[model samples]
Target: MTARNNSFDEQAVLHELKQFLPALSPGKTFTYRNPLEGFQEQTFDDALRHASEMLGYRTTLSLEEYRSLYNSKRVKPGVLEKVLVEKKGAANTFEWQDKVLMKKFPAAAESPSKIGKLRANWQKQYKTDLDARVHPRLFRILGNYLDHGVSDWKFPVRGKGFLDSMREVESNSFVSAFNTPRARNLLLQASSSINDLLTVIVGDEMLFKQYLFDQQFAHRGWSGLVATLEIGREISPNGSNITLRELIVFELLLEIDVLDDRLGRHWEPLSYRLPAPPEDLFAPVPVGEKSEVLAIWQEAVEWSYYEAILAELRQDPQNTRNQTGTRVTETTFANAVDSLCIIGQPSLLRSVTAEHRAFRHGYDFSLDPNGEMLEEILEAVVPSLGVANLECFFARTGLAGMDDILTDQMIGLLGLADTARGDLQAPLPAGLTKDFEPMRLLCVVEQFPETVLEVIDRLAVQSTCVGRRSVGRRSIALWLLNEWVHLVVIDPVSRELRVLKNRKMITYKSAPRIVIEDAVH
Candidate 1:
């Protein structure tokens, strides 16, 4: 132990080994600490890469998870664009967006250390599981030895170091953990250092560190506890002395004993089966396409949420009312039907048409009782007209001046008496009425006169008929389109239809249908 074998400093190696162990100790109180504290000096990306390569940790979300967020609009287009511009600049925004959104990358393969691989051949080739035979007994012994207050009975020679206690127990006990005479002899000796145990098992000075890491990390929970206790971060209530070096020595001896019993004493050191020296665990991790794609997607997903927060922060406090007070209302079914009745107003008609297309493609409309009733009336009319295209049925025809016959028919449809006409009717707004036309009303009546008559005859018997009920202008317009039962009134003086909000009476006339047909044609 005085002279360094193969220039290996046991104290320095033990200190370095502590970096890879789990920092949190098992106890009543739970604490959080980074497991890769050894590589803390490196950048976070580099540290994660080292952990993934050397320790097999999944550091980020999978590509499929990010893609799901994109589909759900959680990863918004504007937010993703901002993220791309910040990372790759404006020129490369589209390229990065395509990679994050559409392009697929293969999963990165892990490059783990080759420390225990040679020993693993025994299990693969001979079908004998060394860990299965060794770990349970080893874990139980270590757990009992390290017990703070849980165990009923204490281990013998508890105050002595881990190796010394194990040696005393094996020497005195009839039922020994070591089945082989060689392992028993090695444990009994006072001068059995970690290097001496490694020499017996691995037979290669360069691989000693790797072999210890591989062995300890296999059961990191137990090894990490021993390492934590050795560092004095955790203390046992029963005063047990343990060193990571002593624990490694005992574990190597146990492995040797298991190998001898299972494969016999003639088996060679693990080094004899090695094809080549193992890779350095602390080497620079290679960046592949998968890592790059994952990095972009991760940033984009994060910024999708972050951009909204940043935008909110940047908004002026004085202008909060402008940002927050405005209510966005969706177009209702009533508004849509009313808009169709406008003639000569091409811009208004085009906008309403676009809304209809959007609604068909899953855009939601604000619905109420009135809108729903209007929709029901349209549903009844649309089929009788033999037109599946609502747009075609509601299409604008040219404006014509209101006449005496058309005026009387419009009054009859409103269920209005001649005297009451003046009560309900108001002069249409100056410029709008001058240009307004009831094109949707004209399209239904003129194009399908016989069909409109037939539908009115059928609806006259139904309870849903607008008999004596005061209905809005939009409802009157929809019924006019369905059965020509009501002519949506243009201002009698102005000769233009009032399209929205004005309430008028509804009366169904069963006789004198020909007069309505003659007026329409």
Candidate 2:
């Protein structure tokens, strides 16, 4: 096509785009890409397709007219037959600085008045009439459908009359509660159901399954969620397994802004097994006699709730310890940075933020209610960091291979203790098999070079050996002078000790202080 003709064609299509795609306001986006053959009137058709979907459009163009337009070679695929709409939600960049998110309130203001006012307003305006909203009802009914089974939805704007309704709730009752504030809690239970259904759906049918599939440990998250939702049938309706329902519940717990759970949450009412409260040592373990407890807690759940016990174990005096932790394991936190090095989860640990970070004589770890609270600390700190910062963590913890500042005694003692820990719980497949393993072992010395000397200075302790002996492990002491880690390790079988890591090579000129020498074994 000549440049002049191309200009004319472009102008004509641009005109049509304005007429057809009138719904694409600034900041709203819709997508349409056509895969037609050669010489297709690419621009006009793409614009037409873009405009069609704005107002409940499902088809781009009718067959007869489209054939005539394409037969004469007025359009071509991969040329102009791609539709772009405005992306939605939020204002533009430069409006907020990159570091704007880093700036948090000086302290959390727990203003009751504002919260009370918002609650009152919510009950009056939204809570009262939420049950009647069409979108909200769709969200809820969908959940019920998942938990109960809904291969046949007639899309009847009414309830109870649908096949799903006749089998579960009374049609009349469903019609009455279809779009009301009363059904909101049911919606919340449905998220797990949807999560389960979607995984099954994608797993069974999708072509490019790996990309979209949730591969979080055989979809354990979905399984856990489904287990929770199945209990909802007696509490919700027969089947209200939907994603929106879970979002409502998550939002409520996280203190995030979301639709009211009763409004759009999907759920299955509980008839058989209602979920019990979290079980763990965090729960009051009445000592004298084993009282008939209401229920049991998973081992992970049990261990997770022991932050107070952990704090006490550390011999805290001030009691100013923050004891809450989250569901983060060691491997997940470490893997967030580089795949080249893999750190398996010896135990679930809480993540620490700058606010909660602390240091003692031999090691550093927050006063978590449970012994491991790394997941919690990381949640707050991970977002405000560089990709490289992912591996950076509190270095003073008893974990070995994380740093080199600790003396061979401190390092060895930790490994032996960890070795004994194998008696408590078996070490996992990817987990490290240390003669003494370090608990909540964190090392960021290499990543955060500025703290290397400071950490070494703190490690200069006289009685670190006592704690090491108590734990059945020892620490290795060395310096990362120049660019090498000059260190030592003790052989478990020999009984007599030897050089840990003699000078093998020195490469990086940027780090010049390190020197390597042959130390006799």
Candidate 3:
């Protein structure tokens, strides 16, 4: 695969690419274009399988992963059986499903040469597994890229172009590295010579397009960067274009250039073979420290939405507070960057983002009648915060000092300040216990006031009979305050609470002050 003259038909390559690549406009005119846009002719499952074969992507879950989902009931075995029966019409679809479940699927296979060598050298030099040794920030960014769920924001690339902004991250950007005379000569040669690699990887234009689609979904950040940089080759209307096949070759050339520096290998044959490099290049930085490079990458990638929020906050000068705090100043930007750097885990970041969004929801609702500010605030907060803390997350925007109100009002309304003290417990029905944790109760009260009163009413009656009921009985007292009333609940057995509800039907919904007295006393 020696370097060829820059005489290859660029149009031919571009023409081949047009059959498969999706036309992606810049982030400014972003739309919900399907990642699988080119494969509209095939079913999702068939497209997944074909793309997996072409790009070495994981098209389906592995047996162990599927088994975990099945056991968790996320993917019910019964449902799979029924679907299989309908689709295959086999005599015993259950038997066929069981066989499919027992089989092991291969994990995505690694490519040859440069990438493989780098991974090997990394393991050999550091005595650390490359996959296990990613920097926290790098891992966080990668998690967000690969996240098929739980992430509300997807593939946010900002700036004049992907490579344009990526250059600002450090003194030496990929653009500068590849734009050098020597790098330029190599790119020209490789650009002209890409058809050879494409011929080996993709027989027809459709397969090449499918490979692009697969690669984009496989690591959208990198693919998106390539797409934006090579917009010149696009065949779409108005000079706008996306051609993933050429982008793959272009990105590979960049990787080869970088690898030439990293390993001091000419790696000229890589231009010929064009083995897929790892989706991203890392310095193989030490495993413990936060990755400043990855942080920079993430910041550049998400700068648009970040600045958009700052701009919107500037419009409303009176409101300086957001869920993440002050939005009108430089500190807000710094805090956003710091959050991106420090959050070690993606799940934790997601949790923090969710909590921050929820806080902004309540806070914005309190501040303005219109929901536009809320939407903007949420969009800004989406990038920061760890999702790891979501399991027990609560909104902390304007709810300051409310915990004290909740506790004191229950005692004041019930007139059981001396009797209940700290011993009262909320007795949940056996059927509802799984859904009735304290944080869940708080979430219900906070978000859905109309939906939670019945449950609260049941809890109130049980609080009244706690000490007198039996030797081993206990109850949980809950206090809720909405716009209308300060409601207190004592949770006990449903039957016992039902008797109280029937006994005090008169004051139940209207006068919370009297309702507490009749139900509890």
Q: How well does candidate 3 match the true structure, expressed as C-alpha RMSD?
A: 24.9
Candidate 2: RMSD over Cα atoms?
A: 29.8
Q: State, as a TM-score between 0 and 1, how close model 2 is to the true structure.
A: 0.16
Rank list by lDDT: 1, 3, 2
Q: What is each predicted model's overall lDDT from 0 to 1?
A: 0.48, 0.22, 0.30
Q: lDDT by residue for model 1 over 363-480, one digit each (tens)?
A: 1112321234334444444323312122221121101111112133233323345663332211121232222212122121111222233443444344443323222333323334
Instruction: State which candidate, 1 or 2, has the greater lDDT.
Output: 1
- Give the per-residue lDDT digits (tens) of candidate 3, residues 84-189: 5544476865564544455443443355111224234333543434233222223233223333333343324332222222233323334343423543455444
Off by over 4 Å in 2: 1-135, 138-166, 174-224, 227-490, 494-521
For model 3 the local lDDT of residue 384 reads 19
| Per-candidate TM-score against the hidden true structure | 0.55, 0.16, 0.30
lDDT of 2 by residue, 240-282 (tens): 3333233323322221112334434432211111133111211
Q: Model 1 compared with the native: what TM-score?
A: 0.55
Residue 193 deviation, candidate 3, in Å? 8.8
